[model samples]
Target chain A: MKYKYWRRSRVIPFTLLLSNLVYVSFGLDPAASAPLVADTAFTKSAFYDQNEQCFRCHGNSKYTYFNPVSEKDVSATMCENRVIHRNEFYTANHRSFACVDCHAAEYDTFPHPGQLRMEAPYNCIDCHGYDEQYAQYHFEEIEEEFQQSTHYTANGDAFTCWKCHNPHTYRINIRNSTSMQQSIAYDNQICLNCHSDFERFQLLSDREEINLIQKHEWLPNQGLHFSQVRCIECHARLNDSLMVAHRIMPKDKSVKRCVECHSQNSLLMSSLYKFQAKESRSDAGFLNSIILNDAFVIGANRNIILNRISLIVFFASLGLMLMHLLLRMIFKRND
Target chain B: MTEKVYHYPLWIRLWHVFNALLCLVLIVTGISMQFSEPNRSLVPFDLAVSIHNSAAILLIINYLYFLIVNRLSGNRMHYKITEKGYVKMLITQFRYYTLGIFRGEKTPFPVSEVRKFNPLQQFAYIVILYWFFPLIIITGLGLFFPEMIITRIFGISGLFLTDLFHILSGFVVSMFMIVHIYFCTMGTRLTSLFKGMINGWVEIH
Candidate 1:
């Protein structure tokens, strides 16, 4: 007892202590006890899946575009890159997924453990196919022509999709990473290979071939400083990395800007880029585009005035000199 | 026997001054026409067009007077007459300019009657008076016709062609004037030629 409290006090109270403690706690409820601090929510693992496992609605979990041969739906896996129409964007491999993945539209997660999905799944090819949709307006056709041309050979990576198309977009658009204007840097990469071959070619001719190339593109060999640079570079405005132009022009494969940007990277610039069977005038396809603009109209109007001024000045000055000469001859009569 | 020492007559001098002043006015008007804009048509367009046109006409009239008077005077240019030894004198003059002019030697081409102009003067005057001035006049007249000067003077056909001629000539003269002014300053001293034109007298040395 002395060891428990003090032996002298324990003699009077040991029996009462046991009886009162039992009485006080006998009516206490087990459910209503104060929760232990160790059981708090702050220390809990937060990966709540909302218990809505996505596979139930999306058909199958591990389905792929490659296995579409065994099944019809997954066959469209490769259909992601299938361009929809003549002017439609070349869709990359994107699959439609749950809306709560990327778009942070309404984030109610107390501690946002990860990203809130925003975009609906990419289900574009559920309607279109490569053979049915893109075969008509293929860059593949352009590349084939480029291959047959004298400018390029099959050894180049002309058949590849990444070479010609920006996979992130539905349309072929340029995006600026470094510059203010939308730059077709990879496209111009094609032009630089041949255009910058000045020092190698050693052609001493006065032809404007070299100058024209330098005029529209970058050439390190020539000491030209560009103020306006290329038409596409400035004309195309930047949207993130995407270069959208003020005018709604589709991604043309044959513009001068295209030549500068893409250069002879594709077979399209090759001498055999045309298949005479299908009428190979395809390299000239984009070049043949001539829109009658008003800028030239203004210049023509101004030139009329400019030409008249020049002619009048010439003739009037002529008459004055002649009058002087005639008078001089008449005055020489005294001699 | 009362031959005048000063060759420039009063009427010719007045016309020269008039033409020069008119050219200045035209330049000013042209400048104001393009005020605040490189190529914009503004309200001052009418004022500029009228002033430039009027000055142009006045210049042409004055130029005619100057041409007739200068030709009659036999003193439109500076020249030298080295008698029968003209070749020797010309060679000497050429050498003096090419070699001796640097050393402050006298000019071989001296002022004279009958052959008042040196080769350079004759060439320059021929270009300016014959080539340049006519180009401006034809162009100006063309423009003036567009403003209806041709309808009162020539008729419908003239009116139709006036603008065409005026515009074309104005362009030619403008180009010529640019080159002329540039060359005019290419003298040994830039201001010397200008001063010579200002007062009809230049120090021979």
Candidate 2:
């Protein structure tokens, strides 16, 4: 009886070891294979779960596919639409929020319902409008401005906030940015993404593809203007309530006059360089002196002291010349 | 017949006239650009830019011609300040303009083939043509090709400094033009010097 008990113990241990080996070789986790409960309990549990739970599948470049031949979970081709770069998401402005905060709780299911893909995304105003906490941001005014924009007028209900600003990555860079050039580059990218890209542009409008160079041919030094200033500097209507002007005017209404931005009271002072102007209010008594820190726009950046001195010298010279002419005429008459 | 001298050659006269025209155009357009307003402008901004740029280009070419001819020809001798008692000569010429001429005094400096300009005129021309003209040209070019300009100088935008220099040089040249024209009237007759530029001869009375 003791011998029989020893043999049974050995057999049971070997069986357990073999099962474990098979499970490991097949890349199967019992916990992962557990059936998903599509119920209130699961949704409530997922609501409190960390971002890693959602990132496990969506953040991965490759999707797991069960291969019958290999009897294992092998990596298949990347699902581009489903993939979200973990690093990018974490660094973005919305990083603090849980995925479920924006996404519906129904997405907690193992295989998210196909219907969820067609779910209407939240509008910017849905959360921000009339909220006292966000009152300072002026979302209501921005909404009003957006309603009047060409983008809204053209696309009607089809256009969303996501058209220009990607909720996943959008940041308040213009107001807070230290470098104007960097802000210009970042902000212009949003416009160029549609305006410069034919495929993306066609998604919004039925017009033929535009060549930016050909369109802006009248502007001297087109490349310099493009790099130095945001597209909205000339395109968008100025709004005092919003940090950025959302009321994008039609092409015909856009600012074309060079002096509009290249003057003592530059239009850019209220728009592209608004934050910079505010920060450096003490301008050494020079007209548009704040612009001199970042750029040198002709007609805009004049030194008050230099201008006054020049005027004085010019008038004095003119007066002396006039006197000289007067004396010459008098001497001639006397002679 | 009045005593006359051939002080200006065909090429010199041509260059001078073209230079004067370009300078006038540039000055007008430059002022318009400087004081341009969005609604009210002296010259329409677009037209001013085109005219200013074209005039600037022509001025550059005219200046080059002046420099090359001055280098190659004996005309350069007129610009040289080599005379003895030069400062005294300048003072005497100054006195002529300020007080002597009203008293019907003869000019301290006379027009001759060897002396195209008086001591004071020579000094003024040298400063304006050789110094201020080149300064305006270089700074104007810098403004034209803004990308090539230094991004900053002494913690100030280089373009701003360049523009300021261009304006200052332009102001000096403009003042010189006015004074130079007035000085030209002090010749034997009021219109004699004007006729001299056109005919390549000056009445030496």
Candidate 3:
């Protein structure tokens, strides 16, 4: 029995060392990730040692979709001849590597618009550890902002940069996408995704509660264009210049009324003000009723007030110059 | 020697001088537009707009006048890209600017009624007259009438894209000015082109 115990003890130690060697050699199957659709042989080809190799097979499938663009066919067959979008690899240095390098997704060949079954955008951190070189990436903040945005807030994971941004072209070419045209017109989706829902702002109890009042320009739809009001109305600038009118001011509602100059719905502003309620699009749903191409005639219509003020200042400077000249003449003659 | 060296008409001289002057005004005003103000514009944005618009119209009209006057006078033959002369002319002028001018060497191509500009000058003038001028006018007009363009052409939705195109055109012009000013230093004398624009006569050494 003692002899048998000694033999077992010798075998256990040997097995432990052997198991340690297995773990070190393979790294818990980082290379052979099962359930993933891609052929691992491609990864074994040693081409994926750099990022550039990832593109060899993946880029082959890039333009394979049924493209209706008559002037430019974006089909995969054409991609071999056509130049890859420069902005796709706009980084200082880009890698052309195997498909499984970054996107470990299974490539579906049979489907019409061959879908890429890949990990989520946030999951990119797995292999791509916080790179010191790309420390200023700000990817997390952008991701968070996109999530908190009202457009996707509760339903965040439903989208990624690929939704609105085509990574291939990497251009926000507004020429395409008939559906996106309406959103661009109705609200600045780029900004709205981060800012508080303009529609959620309930009206203040009194006009005294509103701040940053200017001229009341009645937009179409009984002045219910919250999107227009929050952006263009208060933050108006001449010749597409940037300026601030609301919220940036000290938060004192008594300072200036929000609706004084944002007067699309000014007649209703009084009744709404008495209610002292917050602006909620859900409450009235009047935001959808905003009309287009309405004359922007609102308030006392003194949009050029800033322009006039500058004119006055210019004239004052001229007058001062003339006065100085006259004083110089008198002093010189006396001397 | 002062017997009007070649066939450059008085109208051509006047238009060229006027164009150069107005371009300077537009560029300066354009700088102020970009850097100066948000709402309180010191430069009367309206006046600037009017000045730019009028100047652009004059330029467009002058472009037509150039084509018409030159063709009518049968002077169009001077600017043509002839098979035998094109490459030879271009190389000769390039060599003059790079090496000959600095060495105090005489200009290879002398001015005459038929071939006023050296090949380099002809190429530069042709590009400026055709490509740069047309782009500026079209882009400038697009900016002034954003509503008309967005509504009539692509349905009010393409406003931002149109705006972007206008801004890009401005950027291209900005780049051209930087390069144009640098190259102007390579003139026979450092300020010869400047003097020529003002006086309508380039001194021939």
Candidate 4:
């Protein structure tokens, strides 16, 4: 009986070990096969191990390259293409991902083959499109917007999401930012990176470089407008479903009317101030109450009670004056 | 026979004309901005803003001149209610306008060298110029440089409160302007006060 029990115990553990080995070799682990949605808790040790192997070379500021002629690895200064900031990568939205998840396994080879560099980069839709887990993000809809935008229309396939949004470091600033000013600055920097930089802009268009100040001189308090609000507030075609509007309109198509932002029903309430408006919807006593904390737009920040009272007082004063005039006329006729 | 009193000097007359013109422009533009729709504005929004700003600047200059001249000259006394029974005096003037004027009773307080304005006129001028004028000007300046305005007051937006005060004071001043024009007709003739303002002379019967 003792001999039989020992054999059974040994057999069961061996069998469990063999199954785990098979799962790793075939990428058939139940957790691994599951959908890689946002906020998924990754296997920490394995995820770090996979990424550390790639980062050993990529994360180093003084990365070395193989010198075939010299028969040695020559130290080289880090370039933008190779260097990945360790902190930024770890804190990013895709922090839980393994390096090989997006990149091909061929990149794991040391002194990567030249053909690997030519491999087409993954588009956002390649992994995210048609996936029910990512449907809420509307990646397909963003692709549609990008296709219709001025950037895509003018430059064709040359304009990609990476031009404005660096996937390695991109985060949802509008929703997560501590201040509106910070969010405005962060978003505007993405547009200004290309729009303001003549060298960067020339890559997209050969048109004469724009003088932003002169172009926006028609705006009242141009500096204040630029600092307080994002460029997309007026320039982008608003979509109620999207958190940020991606379909940028041409200059002529952009909003030029002051009433668009300075009315009781301000477009800013839906665009720039969307999150704040959502948070403060309970205080519906005043129009544009969300903006009251940051700004006081004339005609937009109106109190209904004050409006009615002012109108009554104005008409009452006029009525009293008219009554006095009528009484004087009647007395004169009697005399 | 009529006696001519030199109640208004050349500077005062010029100031009155400019003040009237600027105030009228501000009132129209201000109301258009406050009440008019974007598409159906009484005055086009941009043009209204430009005109309103220009008029406001001129009014500020005109107001400063009035203040300096009043301080240097004796005109300030006409605005002071120093009499012991001034409330009674105001009531009497009010009754004269509401009842006695139609009955052809003589004015209890007529225009003279010592008193350029009656008690009622004195009170209205004091409240409008001293109280509402400064309130509107301060609040207007606050709106112009919003950064300088306090961010909050009693847990409410300071800018909103400033705007509310500006609108309220503006409404009162507008009402006063209309009544002031009508009151000018109470002189010997409908055009008498207007002529007096122009020529710097009032005809007392």
Candidate 5:
């Protein structure tokens, strides 16, 4: 009986050690290693600290002022001219970068020297010198076209890529079923931000008369159509490239004919409805991409071969009946 | 002189009337959809689709009624022709339409209880009912489930093939309707066959 009790006691220690080993192997102590992950992931360097310090004054709402009256008290307003909202800066596309990378400023000092005001704003061409980097999406073509656009022609260096995309908040394309609709709306928002803004348009352009509704008076249910299709589809020249055309033209150059969009070779077939190209573009396929696109438009989606065949059959049937009737009438007269 | 004989039954008359109406609706709506354009929508696209689909379902039901009734009543024999001298019978019927009818010659195969249709009609009816109707229904159903089963077919989108076959079959059926209607005028009196359909009896001479 004493030997049996001694054997059970020895077995209990072995089982306990084995269970502990199993627990350790299966990552039972997640909390103990969490700090190590956090330290490595968010390691703060001297430059990063300087960026954080700069945001302390410029980003904080309490320290930054917009109105001239608020700037009178130097103690109240740490950032006198510009106020970068804390949340906006943190969520910006360039949030990962240090301020010193874009701006030549003193990093060692606690209070930034007054000399920082003289520094020029960052140029986009500095980092994106090589065009080949954007070959996949052909963004270089857009850059080239932007120089020839109405904005560039009028504003010259005043309008840049950052004005539209706003690197501080821009993100990669959001791909979904509604991605095309969202993209069209997003792009239009940029144009409307200035064009629809009365004060801004007056300040920017020579022509003060700006009314989007008035411009599109010819289109029936203008509001609904505008919401559905992209503005660029008509305003710009249709191309195989993914980039939106910046070459804004006069009203005469825009797509005016109903057949333009209602035909098999419609611009929407290649661009907005491109997702359907694979399935609808078969040689034996009856419909093109535009017709297969969500709502079936009559003339737009019609197959050319089917149309010809139907017409031929219709006429042939009518002709055959006419000939038979004539022969029957002639035979009756002879009888 | 002609003797009055029972030709159509009540159920058959009802089926014929309903089938005719359904086919008319289907043809009109289908053609309107085919010719639809941005500026020229004969009927709204949604309404056209709804009407076409509703009529199709009803027509299918009507077809099943025909199949069930004809089979039960043993009236399906009217559509079948005996192999012996079938081709000769068909030629005689054709000649009656193309030549003999102009000279007011008697029909080669007159209407009877057992032989409801002439050889030519039996052949035509068999082709139209057995061949064309099935093709139209299959293609129409294929279009309804385009995403799942009808996307790709024979190196082309199945939707395309479906639409093509549907339109072509519809056109042929439409032509058949015209010819069928015209043949109704070929009876002894213009209104004689129509009266027979209404009263379920024909005055056979």
Candidate 6:
């Protein structure tokens, strides 16, 4: 029964591909020539029913395959994983956004325009174009930051924001401490999507493969560090902004030493630990504003009282001992 | 005329010289590291850390060697103050240092083959070897292994407290070194104890 189910499902996609190929060989439009074919999928409307309409085809658990990029076939499992989860959009930070805001403006038009391509519904730069005055708006400043990013520098035109954030499901400003950890892990997962997958990485870039474990062998509990801290914390250049910088450096240039994080003025405090506004002050009196936060750093969080008291006692004890020795020497000479 | 007696053993002399040099290196490097920053450091921070940790390891080995020698040669008994009249012995030693030494009065306890230290010297040595050294070493190990099980057991603040103890104990030891150097000069002839440390014999008046 399972074999029959698999055989039937496999034949449908191949048949569709053959028909498309036949039309393409004749130099005629494949789906455009036949209006009835595209009609079954999309219902014409003035407004978009984003949830049901988009997911109707995308959510299907079928073995539909396509080469989204050059010569590399993305499988059915990958497509379903990418698009099927509609519930995620509702919970996502971008929940209020309509599908058409990013997708084709009039995507519900009966037989979609001959000019429209299935791929690249909208480029990131299309919506997020630079605006000098309103630079603080979500898109403009991030676009500026992205331009400076190592990804953009390394891959030039090849890298896009979509490589890191899936527009359908990305979230932001996750402040709850417990969930913040998961949010950090989620963000890092996006980086690992390309980095951890050697095959996928090689398809896009010519850089050497990274062995994360070997790279971070000097650090103890490397897994814990990978999870707790974002990759950009060490990899990116530190900027005045609290967020991790976009300009990623090579591994050798990255801060891997133990003293970097465990010192009196740890850089982690400026980036990760600066969740609260008040904690950002570089000099807020005793022990600095960094250690005063809720977190306890091992070597960095020194007690001011203990340090001051110890110093006083150390000098007083030394002074008394010296005085006693001098007095005895003077008295001996007198006698 | 003064009588000469064999005091410091060959191993003791060697360990003493090595330990003195190691302690000097540790003190200098440790001070530089404490105030070190990227923009401002007495020595390069990495170099200071390397020297400090390496000297600490050597000091640990030298300390262990001294411990073994004390045990095998039964020199541990010299540092043991009897429970009875311990306070009186301290008082007498204190007076001898303050008044009696200047007046050329006889000491309550004199260095001998069996009794290597006076009561006050014995107490100070006991405190440094048994108490301070162990505290500093344990804290140093704690700094090295920040993520060890003890860190979890003691909570996050415990490690900072351990560092504080290490620093304080080191400060006390540095002060002890200053006093110890001066006392080393106080032997019957100024260089008598110094010569003894070098050649294993002290000329006692």
Candidate 2 iRMS, in Å?
Answer: 1.6
Ranking by TM-score: 2, 4, 6, 5, 3, 1
Residues A9-50, candidate 1: write the lDDT tens digits: 233333343233222222132421222121122322121232
Candidate order by decreasing DockQ: 2, 4, 6, 5, 1, 3
* Highest TM-score scorer: 2
Model 5 agreement with the true structure over A154-200: per-residue lDDT tens digits: 78877777666665444322122334446567667777877788776
Model 6 local distance difference test score: 0.64
Q: Who is ahead in lDDT, 1 or 3?
A: 3
Model 2: lDDT equals 0.78
Across residues A1-335, which tens digit of lDDT does each residue of candidate 4 receive?
32332243335543343344334322255543332222234334246777888888788787776888999989978776678776667655455556665565677887677886765555666545665655666888988998889989998878888888776666556755556777798899989998899999998898999999899988876766887789999999988877678899999999888777777788889999887777666445667788776667776777777777777987887798888888878887888
Residue range B98-182, candidate 5, lDDT tens digits = 7787777888888765666778878988988888988988887766644444445554545566776887888888878877776
TM-score of chain B of 4: 0.96
Tell me how far the alpha carbon of residue A236 in candidate 3 is from the true structure, in angstroms, after superposition.
Answer: 9.4
Which is better, 2 or 6, measured by lDDT? 2
Query: Ten residues in a row with the worst lDDT in model 3 chain A?
Result: A238-247
How high is the lDDT of residue A22 in model 1?
25
Q: Can you tell me which runs of candidate 5 are displaced by over 4 Å?
A: A1-267, A270-299, A326-335
Error of 1 at A184 (Å): 44
lDDT of 6 by residue, B85-173 (tens): 88898999998887787677877787765667778888998999899988888887776655552433343445456666777788778
Shares of reference contacts reproduced by the candidates, in order, are: 0.02, 0.64, 0.00, 0.31, 0.22, 0.09
User: Which 10 consecutive positions of candidate 2 chain B have the poorest summed lDDT?
Assistant: B107-116
Candidates in order: C-alpha RMSD to true structure: 29.1, 13.9, 23.3, 9.5, 17.9, 13.1
Model 3: per-residue Cα lDDT at residue B144: 59
What tier of docking accuracy does candidate 6 attain? Answer: incorrect
Error of 3 at B55 (Å): 3.3
TM-score of each: 0.30, 0.85, 0.37, 0.82, 0.53, 0.72
Query: Least accurate stretch of 10 residues (summed lDDT) in model 1 chain B?
Result: B34-43
Off by over 4 Å in 4: A1-75, A105-109, A276-285, A332-335, B85-88, B95-105, B151-158
